[model samples]
Target: MPRIPLVDVKAQYAPLLPELKQRIAEVLEEGTFVLGPNVAAFEREAADYLGVPETIGVGNGTDAIVLVLNALEIGRGDEVICPAFTFYATAEAIVRTGATPVFADIDAATLNLDPADVAERITPRTKAIMPVHLFGRPAPLAELSKLGLPLIEDAAQAFGSPAVARAGVASTFSFYPTKNLFAIGDGGLVAVTDPELGERVRMLRFHGSRDKVTFEYVGTNSRLDELQAAALRLFLPRLDGWNAARREAVGRYAELGLGELCDLPTDEPGHVYHLCVARSAERDRLRAALTEAGIGSAQYYLPPLHLQPALRYLGYREGDLPETERAAAENFSVPLWAGIGAEQQERVVQVIRAAARVPAAS
Candidate 1:
């Protein structure tokens, strides 16, 4: 087998090259690079797709979180509870708001913020709960909502997920090159049902200005540029199709009969398989075998956020989160992407089986 990438970003653009290039050329010819009509049109499309009243485009995902939190007045000594097993962005956003990020343990199966565990962590200072839809499955939104704190969703990994019954006060998404809904460069949005909340995100992304010259809330510049917005538009129409492909690829992985040998992701509705993670006692061995076979694999969050060096000041030691620590130690993802073919998936199974020393079910 030849080399496989975790995701082929260039391959993603190739099928839609003509449309993508035409869009970019139009934007270039018009010379309205920043905060242009393309961005406005894309925002409207995103809102419609998300079933929300408004979607505010921004420079990046982190800024989307910052803007929403700022608009919600969740800064300066507020506490935002989130999972410790997710990407650092979740906690980093909370800290940037001058709020304490109270890390909670995740559900072992879903790898999402565990609602039961969260109840124990709430305090008088706890103002919000940020549940990451880790692995593109909706977080336990209904269970989390019963806690009665404001919910801010980190839907960065969940662009094409099936709809959840409930929504948070705000939800943010990333359009980084590798996401389900990707862009050529950094792009992001804050989606909201409330018109008032939508307006706050819109103003916050543009230096807190209702108009270009006037400043309203001491906000920063986080506008999504014309190129990224244009690129996103080209890809937007194909997002669901690509996600369906990803789902099919994961199904192929399961059909290889590898589940008995490793912990495979289940067929959960709303799961877009952002990473088709599997667990093994032989995690490192499987990863090494994939590397030797010229197949790509990854440990998406190997350390878990609380153990990261930057957050040591929070005083969380090892063994603090048992499920999170166990997950960090045992899971790795296979190369599952929109364009991955069955032959390639078979090769991946070959490598993993070799590492696990398991005979293929004959």
Candidate 2:
């Protein structure tokens, strides 16, 4: 069997080659490399697709989160409550803003932030709650909305997910090469429901420039380039179909009954499966087995953020987040891309099943 990649970017690109080539040629001809017409066009299209008034393109997802925090004035001594089970970027963004990350446990079933636990973690210093839609599933938006705290959605894995309007704040998306609605390289965007907040993000992404040459505030250099934006324009319309295919694949995997041995990925109405993950008692072993069988499986987050060495200053200790710790040890993600074929999926399923049936001693 051929080695199956976790994401077949090449396969996806093959079909879009002609259009991609045309877009790149246009960019090259115009010589507008930075935030130009293409970038603006993509932002508008993305905003419409996400059902938001504005979407500001940025350098990457991490920057998107940091910019939002900065715009919200969530700096020194502020406590940002977030689940420790998500990617390091979520917690890292909080720390980057000079704010403290108050770790909360995740729901075992959804692998998302537990709203009850999040509410419990909130103190007077709590300025915001950043809920990550991990692997492609939407976080418990409805439950989290009742708190009335600022909600910065770490929607890096959920670009095309069904929109769940939160009461307090904005949602951030990543267009990293591996994301569901990816760009050629590093890219990100922010969707702000609040007009004033959205305007602030636009300025923050471009060196806090209120005017052409006047810098109003301290800001970072993080703007999405024109070439990537153009590519995204070519790809945006296909997002729904791609997401639908992922859903179909998820259904097939579930029907295979592998969930008996491993906890299958769950959905909540409007999720777009960025990655189809599973929880297993023997996660590490199963991952190794899949690799040996030429199947590419991944561990979404092995070391929960609270347990990371860099986060020691936050005062978190071992067993601080029991649910997060449990998930970090057992969760693994499998290939679920737009270009995945039926044969490849079947082979992946077969290998995983075979791996699961093997005894640990062997």
Candidate 3:
């Protein structure tokens, strides 16, 4: 293992282990495995926390998007506008619903969907707009709302962001292990302000049955299991605190003068800093230097989705999305996690300084 990892899940969960174990034990003793009381209780707590009317727990984040599309009745011959620079699952979910994903350019600074670009991409077939809170920076939801289309927020990276999950027509979250609010295993949810839409999502997650016997919309099986839901209940209350720690770590990186070596992610109050991404013309060199120093690092979305061989048929060429391509080529993520020490951040900056031939921080 590296001296520091990109995210230390073990460290994040260590403090909660005893509580988590007790929760798991209770789940086992209850004999309510799938979509049980724990799942319902978690859904209520999460919905309350997000200030939404309801939340429907599902199998994973990708399914949450698909469920919302199905609930909205968006399907074949429909178009959903989204950013191409995000995780492939965003577009993949749209395609899975038989809707074409219209790619839009992202803002250069926030690395989120540019509302202006989204306006240019709109058409009569545009049924919805999906904006990702990329790297925990809230997307321009207020501007996107003016487009007069349904807004579905892909908030997988930004569970604790202020005013994020509340703005969209519906929002999706992933409780993957690395997330600020995480479960021991995969879990996801869809938050909706509309109770009718919430009921539709709830039914869709459980094989389209309001009751087990009657199938309504031909929905797939995607319920969040009791074990995962129980674990999430333990973590949800602490999400804001964890997000604060992540923000603090980003501030420490800035103080260590890592920003002098490369462009650090913008320090937005709402940004939870899921990944402490930095942009350098020398990203490859910087990553290599960190690797040699026994540190963990990573690069995100190198092909920028539009240029991926799988997406070539979208008729997008190399330069179609300039900002997205630039980000893909220049971005690298360094070690970041809740409770990371200042010394660790300083060491990371020292390696970065050497790689970029910059003076050390005083």
Candidate 4:
């Protein structure tokens, strides 16, 4: 058998080719590439899908975060509280905007930002709270709301996850090719409950231009192009089904007792499994075993951002973030892509189970 892939994008694309091809051809005929009708349509559709008032397309997920922060006027001397256990982009966006990134621990079971810890970390400088729907589980939004700060939902991984709830704040999503609701390439969207804030994001995403020649503020170039927008428009309607398939894979992993050896993800009522991850005491050993067995698994993030050498200036120490440190050491992601087959999933579970049973050295 061929080596089990990490994400089977090709498998998913094969079925959608006819429609995808026609859409590309239509864009070519129009020759109106930048932020054209396709982009507007996608924005509308995505907003409706997310059940938000408005959605603004941008260059990518990172820019989506930065643009929203910009619109909120969060800059120098401000502090944005975010979980340290997420992809670096979460805190990186805060740093880029000249704000300080205040690291908070995540909930051990869900791996989402711990709202209680967030409240503990808030200071006079606190400007916003960025809660990531890590591994497709929404953060504790109900608890975070009590803080009364702007909440930026990092919905990059939880695109179609049912855990997405109205946090009465702005949210951002990544449409990178691998995401649940993806485009052909890099793309992003910003969804906001506040209408005025939504309009500001639109301006910030396009060089802060209010009109063609009228620049209202200094902003970066971060507009989503027409080609990617068209592709996403075609793919959006299928998001729920794709997410359901991923959930089924997760169910199979659970039924096989993989959770006993490896810590399988927990399902909340509203969650949509993005990349089903698990915790293992011997993460590296299990990863090597799976690779040798022709099953592809990945370490989502081996080192938490607080411990990264580049961020030493942030004045963090090893013991400063206990939960983040533990998560970094133990977590690894398995293939839960929409089109991953059951046979492939079985092989993957077998390899992981075998690896987990191996004796650890003292």
Candidate 5:
């Protein structure tokens, strides 16, 4: 079999090339390279798609979180509770604001922050709860809301999930090349339910100025540029179709018996399957097997945020978050992308089943 990539980004954009290039050319011709018309149009389109009143385009996903945090006045002495079973940027964003990140364990089934666990981690100084829609699975926002802390969704992987797409006080998205909704390069946005807060985040993404010349608060330069925004505009209308295709691929994984051999991610109506992650006690061995077959695979959050060297000062030990630790030791993502063919999926499943020595489901 030919080498199967974990994400065939080229395949996704191949058919869209003519239009994409035209969009890029328009940006180049206009010479409004930064915070121009395309960015403005994309922000409005994304805001409408997300069903939020406003969306502020920024340079990247990390900046989206930092800008939102700054707008909320959460820093220095406050704490932001989030899961340790996620990417480094989740916690890193909190620490960047001079606030301590209070790491919580994730739900074994969904790999999102366990709200019950979040409640236990909260304190008088806990300013907000940042629940990641990890791997595009919407965290339990309805449950998390009852805890009475502000919810700032780390929605980097969950662009098309409408259920939680507009639920929180604010949600952040990354338009990284591989995301469900993506740009040619880095870009991001913040969706806010409150237009007032949206304006604050908007100003913060620039130099904290409503009109660029009048600086109201000290801020950073993180504006989403015209070129990237133009690419995103081309991709935006097709986002739902691509997400649905990803869901279809995930269903195909189950039909091929991948689910029986490994713990497949729980399928929610909103899950876009950003990556079809599966868990097995023999994960390392399975990853090795996939590699031997020239098939791609990866482990998500191997170190788990709390155990990362940079965050060790938070005093988390090896066994602190049992479920998160176990997940870090076992989760492996199989090859999955929009429009992935059945033959490739079957090849991936065969490799995984062989590596685990598991029989196909009856």
Candidate 6:
């Protein structure tokens, strides 16, 4: 087997090289760089694609979350219920806003924030619920909506997934090179149905000024660069097709009986399959076998966010969140980028099967 990467962005980008070069040339020739025509154009296109009225592009995904919270007026001593199993940025945004980030447990099935756990954590201080669509599947918006608090979707991994953007008060997207819809460098977008909130993000991204000289609020300079926007425009048209390809690769894993060897993700329509993850008590051994076979694998997260030392002040212990703790320990993602071939997939399964001798817990 040849060497595989956990995410082969080069494989996904190669076929579109000519178009990327052309678009990048146009941006250079125009010279209207920061938040220029290309940036505005991508915002309009992304808004249409996601079924939201507006999309405000930002410097990166982390800033997108911060912009959304600031617009909502959530700060200082307030609480935001966020899942403990996600990237630190979700909770970090809250901390930066001076709000307490109350960590919630995740559902073992979807590896998403558990609604019941979320309800248990809610208090008068709770301002919003940020349900992360972890590993490219939508979280339970229906149940979360019933809680009567606004929802902010951390959709960094769910860019092309169906109905994910439509579920929350505001949905955030990351265009880091690995995401389904991405740029050559880091970029982000915040989509919202409400024009007022959309305008708020627009102002918040550029030092809180509606006009160039007037500073209306305490905001940061975090606009998306026109070059990255132009590059992303090249891939926007092919996003669904690429997402379909990832889904197909995941199906091949099921067909090869990899599920019996480890815990597999569900084949849900809303899932864009960012990472073809599975759980195993033998996860470490399996990763070693894949490495020896020149097949790549990664632990999506080894320690859930609540237990991370940075958030130790949150006062959580080892057993505070049982499911989140277990997920961090047992789960790891396998190689399944959009352009991966069946032969590469077969090698991944073969290596795992060889390593999964003991019966794994479901």
The count of residue-pair clashes in candidate 6 stands at 0
Could you tell me the lDDT of residue 245 within candidate 3?
Answer: 91
lDDT of 3: 0.89
Instruction: Name the TM-score of candidate 4.
Output: 0.97
The digit string of per-residue lDDT tens for model 1 on 1-362 reads 46987678787678888888888899999999998998999999987888888899999989888899999999988999998888899899888888889999988888888899999999999999999988777898989999999999999988977653147988999998888899888999899878898898899888889988889888899999999988887788898999999999888888887786788877777888887888877888889988988988888676888899988998999999999999899888888778987888888887787779643222
> What does candidate 2's lDDT look like per residue over 1-362, in tens digits?
68898888777668989989999999999999989999999988987887888889999999999999999989999999998888899999989999999988998888899998998998999998888888888888878888888788989988887754344388888888888888999999888889799999999988899676999878888999999999899889988988898889888877866666578876678888888888887998889988999888888666788878898777788888888888888888888888688888788778877878633220
Error of 6 at 306 (Å): 0.7
Q: Kindly report which residue stretches of model 2 are placed more than 4 angstroms away from their true locations once superposed.
A: 164-168, 358-362
In angstroms, the error of model 4 at 214 is: 0.9
* Ten contiguous residues with the weakest lDDT in model 6: 353-362
For residue 207, model 1's alpha carbon misses the true position, in angstroms, by 1.2
| Each prediction's TM-score versus the true structure | 0.97, 0.96, 0.97, 0.97, 0.98, 0.98
Clashing pairs in 3: none
lDDT of 4 by residue, 1-362 (tens): 68987888878778999999999999999999889999999889888887888999999999999999999999999999998888889889999999999999988788878888888999999998999988788789888989999888888888876556378478889988878888888998898989899999998887789786998988889999999999998888888888888889999988877887788888877788878888888998999988898777888655788887767899998888888888888888887788788888888888887768743222
Tens-digit per-residue lDDT, 1-362, candidate 5? 68999999989989999999999999889999999999999999998898999999999999999999999999999999999988899999999999999999988888888988999999999999999998999899999999999999999999999877566789999999999999888999999999999999988888899986899998899999999999999999998999999998998998987888988887886887888888888888899999999999999997999999999899999999999999999899998888889999999988887788654223
Show the colliding residue pairs in model 5: none
CA lDDT scores, all candidates in order: 0.86, 0.85, 0.89, 0.86, 0.91, 0.90
Which runs in model 6 stand beyond 4 Å of their true positions? 360-362
| Model 3 Cα RMSD, 1 decimal | 2.0
**Which pairs clash in model 2?**
none
Evaluation by lDDT, superior candidate among 4 and 5? 5
